[model samples]
Target: MMNRARITRVGALAAASALAIGGLTACQSGGGESSGGDVTITWWHNSTSDPLKSLWADVASEFEADHPGVTVKVEGYQNEELQRTLIPNALRSGGGVDLFQAWGGGEIKDQVAAGYVKDISDAAADTIEAVGPVVSGWQVDGKTYGLPFQYGIEGFWYNTDLFAEAGIDAPPTTLDELYTAIDKLKAAGITPIAVGAGDKWPAAHYWYNFALKSCSPDTLKEAQSQLVFDDPCFVEAGELLQEFIDSEPFQDGFLATSAQQGAGSSAGMLATGKAAMELMGHWNPGVMGGILKDDAGQDDATPPEFLGWFNFPGIDGTAGDPTAALGGGDGFACAQWAPDECVELLEYIESEDVQSRFGEIGAGIPVLPAAASSITDPNLQQVLEGLQSASYVQLWLDTAYGPTVGGAMNDGIVALFGGQGTPEDIVKAMQDAAATL
Candidate 1:
């Protein structure tokens, strides 16, 4: 197994800059370097650990085998580090980075506008055909620039034992019922929802999903493209989300907990019967699995039995359908200055074989439906089924909005949780931000 921490060794092929050693002359080939028969292509990503990193290496090796004599130098960075330093630095023309990953939306779209990335429509035609409409999510300006690679949808995770103990018959299917369920769980001395407001992004998720549930996909799409924030749908969504937070369903001190701390704490609470539910993504299975395994010693190690999930229920009589989903995920974006070898590398990654391998390694859900059939992991299968049930899918609010829109939503959410803002106050802030955008 490839340890994710060893990415610098196996993932990175080029250092900060290329060097010219004495008498070891090298010419710039299609991907970047040409020495003998080696075609070194610079590939960058943000997945730096665990099964996700391991799966990527397996795919890279397969790609190498498919194209004899071509070696992909897969470089990786930690999520925050990549966004803050590596990506900005790589944007300089001729930086030796041919391909990299980005959270698809304004960030990548802005890159497209700046001419920093390539339009891979023709190169990815076959992939689009094989991957189906799911690939369209990454398209911009009538051009397909990247592949919808690894992805997972967001939803609510709950403790099955807690539900049974509270005499809850089923997971809530509507907001009213959801609150009722929460009340029942609270009476049993368990927090109904576990929220980590400390990490601004996690707090942002609640507001984002609430907006998605109240708005139509087309309206949200328009808002994303134009950076519009004041759309009535947004106000309605913000208000809905604020009400949930105000219900006092989250555990005490949730407002003070950081996202990192909240994730483990929330899962721990569920496992030890401290909380009944958590809003999370499919990737959480691995975290939950690791925690459960560690809690049980050696031969006695087994996953907790109470773990399960449900989509965040929809608001009744709202414009949004009950089946709409909110999601955020990673995808590849080609540098506009990329050489042929770099483009070829992307084509290879999008192929059915590579997509199928993604599932086998347990790296969340593969974006391609055909690839979903090959995932042998039962838990991932459950996740895929849940995703397929959605009537519509909305990009995560932060990824879908400009920094201003996202920031306002994040601040409004934190303020609401801290008891310093009202539903009207939050909605007004969102509307004001959208108006400026």
Candidate 2:
């Protein structure tokens, strides 16, 4: 029988709607070799927030100290920007950063198929085993192309104080209960949900979670690999999302709000108590903590105690299990032509000591089992429990489907949120986009 972690290896989607704006072309065939003497490993990651950002710098410095004649040059970019633009451009250009951020799904598969990423199976075998099967998203045909350092599940991050104000005694566990809570919050003059629809992927997550509840695992798996969406559940997901929209649960002008930007963003809304809840992954606390500030606009030393979480509610009479979940993790992959030290740096990042420190600093939900004990945040602990107990985990839909189809699906979902599209529109868009792939 497979281990618990192995059973939890299910994949999730990523954020990259920019592929629709400007096409993400296939990577070129060949890349230039790294320079010889005085080697430098260029590492790029999406750790723009504090502590984690500084923590990465410290990790790089430590690596350089241990290995003579090598320099680890690290650069950080915002998550959406890095995934949607920088990384895609680098892969197409074929000779840039040595190691860059990767989510390991259809995206990495595209890079691997195009010969843009290296196969690190033999090079980092020990580290791969240590990380365990949660790295499944990073593998293709049993060959490892990247290493996942953080893995987690998605759920609703709520403001407990606000929930009490709205008279919601307990978090909703079913679709009917969720709608009731939304109505109650509205009656109490509160914005029930805060969504960053300006960033298309955030809005797309709504449709994705609904699909997870509506479709069977076998149906979802077939759709991921074959891009087939003939199942009625696909349309059912859109209808469910539309019903939620009809309840007017989200904040006003949500379409203009970014996911994680400033005080006006979705994360900011939750942090500032402007909204009651947000649908986000386990990484929410770290990002939310970074953006939270005092009256003087300086970073707050303490995390918001009002922050709480609950699983996405299950739809009644669905083929999907209520225990099923949707999520994925952050990983890094070496460029095809990066220096040998690139693999070494990957191994170093996943070491027990570093991963434990990563958890201690609240960087993310560490994938290393030994480091699990270091996680003290109750909100993150809730996410960990959900991940461990999930009947089947599904990767983010966009991530599971790759760039072309994923991009189209995101655009289609965003159109629905804007009141310009319908359930059939999203299904048709996906079907059309899949035909190309």
Candidate 3:
């Protein structure tokens, strides 16, 4: 596999890397068309909550209204379940799913290899071109397999009111400072950070951030291309994670907490002011708002007025560039066997109007270069500013490395979080998985 290092900026949206891969078995779809010439394409995505959930539903309706005979059966599922199980099973059987969430990276590459995804390069060329290099992750070789709608770096989403109550003045810019803030928050009887350990990926991201700060850009590129992890920095990432875990900054019972499931999940903790901060992505504000809406049972639910964001603090001494960031986007792809309407629906989803609405509501960073003006949300604006200043931006480690190796890596990282694994274990796990490929 070639190193997909070529990065391009899509207006304000930064270019991000791709996702995971896996071999899949083939079968037939449960349904796609009726005998009367009516087309029904099933759409599956990870936005079971409000805001994004409603946005997607409305988009589906608009698509149906424009195309008289076409029906889009859109549904939202939990992210992990959708990405890890349902979609893969549907694809393996060639049933149920027509258009589904496609996180660009090694994941789509594997789907392409299995001949399960449509080559949308021709069908959605205009939208792809409009999004520019930011769509890099969703492409395989040189062809587009999927298209991203949300792309931005991960950072600390904090409750400003809680920060003030804890007597923390500003966001930390270095590891030591973050530790100090953590101490202050703890002294003030507050949980400093919320990690959804039960989900694995959320807790695993701590090591991902540490690796971003510990490894050099060249080392990361070489490792991804060669699937090698001999460098000591990889182990140091786990060491740093272990130290952070030792700090015990997360809330109690965090190991079983879901990331965004309900009012008790990680995002829910931050949304309800039960926690001071959460390390999450640009789309988190939407997730938080959706959580609040669900928990409060009110239509006027919005992200906390005192919500704030800051980049993950840099470690004082590391080979990794302090300016490097970790991020990626969410996109969609058409099943290889789906009707042509599948691609048309993708076109509508990435259209300027739809993308603009995405930005306006803080669902995520819109991919369209022209949709930048629609973002009035201050937190997302801060994220874009950080993206502009970042000297390098890496896709989420689990995503950039693809599924097989990334899965092993996360497993090891989560083990460390639970005090059952060591720093070396995580690197070894990744190395072992890479060896198979």
For lDDT, the strongest prediction is: 2
For each candidate in the order shown, give its overall lDDT on alpha carbons: 0.70, 0.86, 0.86
| Ten-residue stretch with the least lDDT total in model 1 | 17-26
Q: lDDT value for candidate 1?
A: 0.70
* TM-score-superior candidate, 1 or 2: 2
Model 3 is weakest, by summed lDDT over 10 consecutive residues, at: 3-12
Ranking by lDDT: 2, 3, 1
Could you give me the TM-score of model 1 versus the true structure? 0.81
lDDT of 2 by residue, 144-257 (tens): 999999999999999999899999999999989999999999899989999999989999999999999899999999999888999999999999999888888999999999
TM-scores, all candidates, are 0.81, 0.91, 0.92
Candidate 1 — which residues are off by over 4 angstroms?
A: 1-37, 65-71, 92-96, 260-274, 290-305, 376-379, 424-437
